[model samples]
Target: MNTRELETVWAPRMLSVLRIVTALIFLAHGSQKLLGFPASDGMPDPFTMGWIAGVLELFGGALLVAGLFTRPVAFVLSGQMAVAYFIAHLPQSFFPALNGGDAAILYCFVFLYLVFAGPGPWSVDATRRQRSA
Candidate 1:
């Protein structure tokens, strides 16, 4: 149809797709660190910051996938990404590419955007809003 109609109808659905895909990718990072399913160099010790990050990535990614409490979850994840970038990546070099912190920066902004966007359509949050109305 028209561009306006396409945007109106597809954008929210695309947001859901984005959320799901991002969560899956993010979860894999956690799985690598915590579960070691895909196998990594090493697993982080329990309760260490690395392990803690793994916990957040695994659980937070799941929550985002489900779009449950999307705003709050996204807020925490955004903060985590920001902290990760500064703590792990900033020291190596000024440029994100050199430091390999580009993903962190992208995740930070994307999660921050989700904090405002409210997970869009096809989300538990949307369903909850619908039922409550």
Candidate 2:
């Protein structure tokens, strides 16, 4: 394939890959917190802000994994990441590395990007849109 054509075909696929991988990782975070499948700091008590955030991560991460309601869900996820960084990370140090906030920072920006870009090919949203047209 020519360079431009290759780029055209690959770009959307890259987005789908990124969305899927990121969602899975985020879901693991949720699972660790809520389900206690993986080791983590600790599970929050029910109805606490931490518990609520874990709930959001589980459901929202699932939606992102499915590429359903990509924009809105990603937007909310992005906001959650931002809040998490500021509240949990920013207090510890000036740099993300010092504060152990790199994941939060990365997730915040990645989800923010997804909010603007929408789900790419291989997504349920894209399939639904295609079917409607």
Candidate 3:
């Protein structure tokens, strides 16, 4: 295929891939926070805000990876990332690099993007949409 044709063919698939990869990384963050793998010194205590974020990250991220309920879940995850950035990083410094809020900020924006973009062609959402149509 030519460049434009190839782009059209692959763009939605690439979005799905991006969503999956992002979700997997978010899930890993949840795992590290909740399961304490890799020996984190700062694992949040149970029932705390950090733990709660971890729970959302775990389950919501799983949903994202699966591309189920993509819009709502992505919206929620976006909010969570916003909250996480404010609570954890904003206090340290204004800049993301200095405050260590870059990941949270990035997640926030990425989730927001997913909220607008939906689940793309390869997702459960897309499959459901097709069935309904």
On TM-score, the candidate that comes out on top is 1
Give a tens-digit lDDT track for model 2, residues 80-126.
99999999999999899899999999999999999998889989999
Candidate 3 structure quality by residue, lDDT tens digits, 37-114: 656777899999989998999999999999999999999999999999998899999999999999999999999999
Give me the runs in candidate 3 sitting further than 4 Å from their true place.
Answer: none
Name the 10 consecutive residues with the lowest summed lDDT in model 1: 114-123
Q: What alpha-carbon RMSD in Å does predicted model 2 have with respect to the real structure?
A: 1.1
- Reference-based TM-score of each model: 0.97, 0.95, 0.93
Q: Candidate 2: which pairs clash?
A: none
Write out the backbone clash pairs for model 3: none
Comparison by lDDT, 2 against 3, better one: 2
- Which regions of candidate 2 fall more than 4 Å away from where they truly are? none
- Tens digit of per-residue lDDT, candidate 1, span 8-114: 99988999998888988998899899999788999999999999999999999999999999999999999999999999999999999999999999999999999
Clashes of each: 0, 0, 0
CA-lDDT, candidates in order: 0.94, 0.93, 0.93
Report each candidate's C-alpha RMSD, comma-separated, in the order given.
0.7, 1.1, 1.3
Stretches off by above 4 angstroms in model 1 are none
Candidate 2's TM-score: 0.95
